[model samples]
Target: MNDFFSTTILIATVASGIRLATPFLLASLGEALGQRSGVLNLGVDGVMLMGAFVAYFVVLKTGNPLIGAAAGILLGMVFGLVYAFITVNLHAEQGVSGIGIYLFGLGMSDLLFQKLVGTPLPIMPFPEIHIPLLADIPIIGPMLFTHSLIVYVAFLLVPAFTLLLNSTTYGMNIRAVGENPAAVDSLGVSVTKVRYSAIIIGNGLAGLAGAALAIELGIFQHNLTNSMGFIAIALVYFGAWRPFGVMAGSLIFGMVAAIVLQGKTLGIIPRSASDLAAMAPAVITIFALVLVANRFKQPAALSKPYERGR
Candidate 1:
């Protein structure tokens, strides 16, 4: 406990926490976008898995992180189109469709990996980009500055997304569609179009999130996301469906996870219990959500298919 109080160790832990939070922040922001447009995509996990594999394969072949990230986003956007088609256009059961997507991604990613690269191989990840003067500042510097391009991009997106939801025309359309599709439809806005766009954006972000995760880790395997996608969905609720809230939720999870890992390393937690220790962040998130479950409201039409005629 005393050792944990040291300034250097604390800063390192916080820096690591920020790094760990990137994937969650990206995925949660994407989901928040979809939910705001009245779409609930529970298959974000599957999307992430697919994105991770795609990014990994791209980086393995090209040795370029930028191309890998783009590939992930592209692959995810294509799948997002399928998800939007089923739920938004065809009016399939959103929940069931999402589960099917999840299963498909899970199986397909593993299958492709096995067939393409039977043995796991190492790959280059994103290179860290440090802000010149800011990185040299005291504790806050490293925790906030020195990080990969995706990390900065992920955090920057919070404000950009918040502005999009709160101040932009498209943002208003999304909120209007989510809260009252009939009203939006009556006003000449296409409900399906808005929802489709939202879904694509969400899935694209999820893909980027997966790609970032795989690139940062420099490796991939079955279930690489390890249910982090579900955790991102929970973050939407935990954030009360707001971008800043979602960011906060992600940071909390990241910090807790970093702490847990630090504990294992410091021998504060027995090696035998490391697995259980890892559950701490998710458990904490669940408990936090439970406490505030009734306090926040989600988009009114979330999970309900919208048909202009019906």
Candidate 2:
């Protein structure tokens, strides 16, 4: 116990926690955007799986994490288009279509791996970039400034999203659309266009989240994300559909996961309880969801397909 609280161990844990938060932050931010535009995409987990596999395969073949990340983003956007067509254009039930997309992604990713790779392989992950002066600070620097580019980008996005959602014309349209699409449409804004744009951006971010996770770990396996996409979706509710709130939620989950991993490494968590320990993050997520559900009111039009006339 004493060792776990040591300065070195604590710093390491916090740094690892920040790193672990990257994927959650990215995915949840995207989901928030979609929800803000009145779309509910429940297939985030499937999209993440597809992104992870594609990123892993690209990195394996090209040895460039950047290219792999790009590939992941592109694939995610493609999925986003399909999802938008079903839910936005075809007016299919968002929940059912989302599940179908998830199932397809899950099966397809695994099948691709079996046919193409046959075994898990390690790939070159993104290298850490230490901030010039900030990274030199004793504990603060290492914990906050030294991380892969994706980690920094994920954190930076909190502020970026906050600004975008609050200050931009399109952002206002999104909010209006989510709350009352008919009004926005009557005013000449195309509800379909706004929703489609939001979905694409949201799914693209989910893809990038998956790529970040795969590259951060430098390996990929079947179910590598372990339902992290679903967790990311929950984080949207936990965050009350806000970027800063989502960041807070991601950090909480990340820190808890890091603590659990650290405890295991220190043998503070007995081997007999390893499986139980692994459940800690999920347990935290459920409690958080319960606590926040009543406090936050979701968008009025969420999950309801908009037909201009009806």
Candidate 3:
């Protein structure tokens, strides 16, 4: 236990926490955008699985992480389009359609993997970038400034999304649509267009999250995400649909995960209770969700299909 408190272990734990937060940050940000436009996509996990496999396979073949990441984003957008068509155009029940998409993504990704690559093979992950001056700072440097490019991108997005949702015209339209589609429609805004745009972008981010995960880990497996996507959805609520709030939630979950992992490695956590220790993050998520649900109200139009008129 004393060894666990040493500076080296502490710094490593913090850094790992930040790294682990990347996918959660990316996925939750995307979900926040979709929710703000009155669309709920519960299939984020499925989209993530599809993205993870595509990114892995692409990198395996091309040896380029960039191309693999792009392919993942594109595949996610394709799924987003289908989801938009079902929920936005066809007026299907958002929850049911989302579940269908999830099932499809889950089954299809595994099927493709089994048929195409019978054995799991390792791939190169994204390389880390150390910020010049920042990386040299005491303690804080290694804990925050040295990491894969995706980690920085994930954090930067918090402020970018905050600006987009609070200051931009399109952002206003999204918020309005989520709150009152009828009002936005009366003002000549097309709710369908807004919702569609939000969904595609959201799903694309979800894909990127998956790609980041696979690339960060340098390997792929069946159910690589292990339901991380669903946790991202929960994070949307945990953040009260706010970008910065989402970042906080992601960090909390990430840090908890890091702590658990560190404790296990240091023997502070016994092997017998390792499974229970692994459950800490999920338990925290559920607790956070409950608190947020009670304190913050979701968008009024969430999960409801909007038609211009009755």
Best by TM-score: 3
lDDT of 2 at 119: 76
Whole-model lDDT for model 3 versus the true structure? Answer: 0.92
Highest lDDT model number: 2
Candidate 1, lDDT over the whole model = 0.92
* Candidate 3 residue-wise lDDT, 39-104, digit = tens: 999999999999999999999999988899999999999999999999999999988888888888
TM-score of each: 0.97, 0.97, 0.98
TM-score of 1: 0.97
Deviation of model 1 at 225, angstroms: 0.7
What is the per-residue lDDT of model 1 for residues 1-310, given as tens digits with 9 covering 90 to 100? 7778787888889989998899999999999999999999989999999999999999999999999999999989998999999998899988899889899999999999999977989999888887999999988787788899999999999999999999999999999999999999999988888998999999999999999999999999999999999999999999988899999999999999999988888888899998999899999989988887579888899999987678
Better of 1 and 3 by TM-score: 3
What is the C-alpha local distance difference test score of each model? 0.92, 0.93, 0.92
Question: After superposition, which runs of candidate 2 have C-alpha atoms over 4 Å from their true positions?
Answer: none
Q: Which residue segments of model 1 deviate by more than 4 Å? A: 270-276
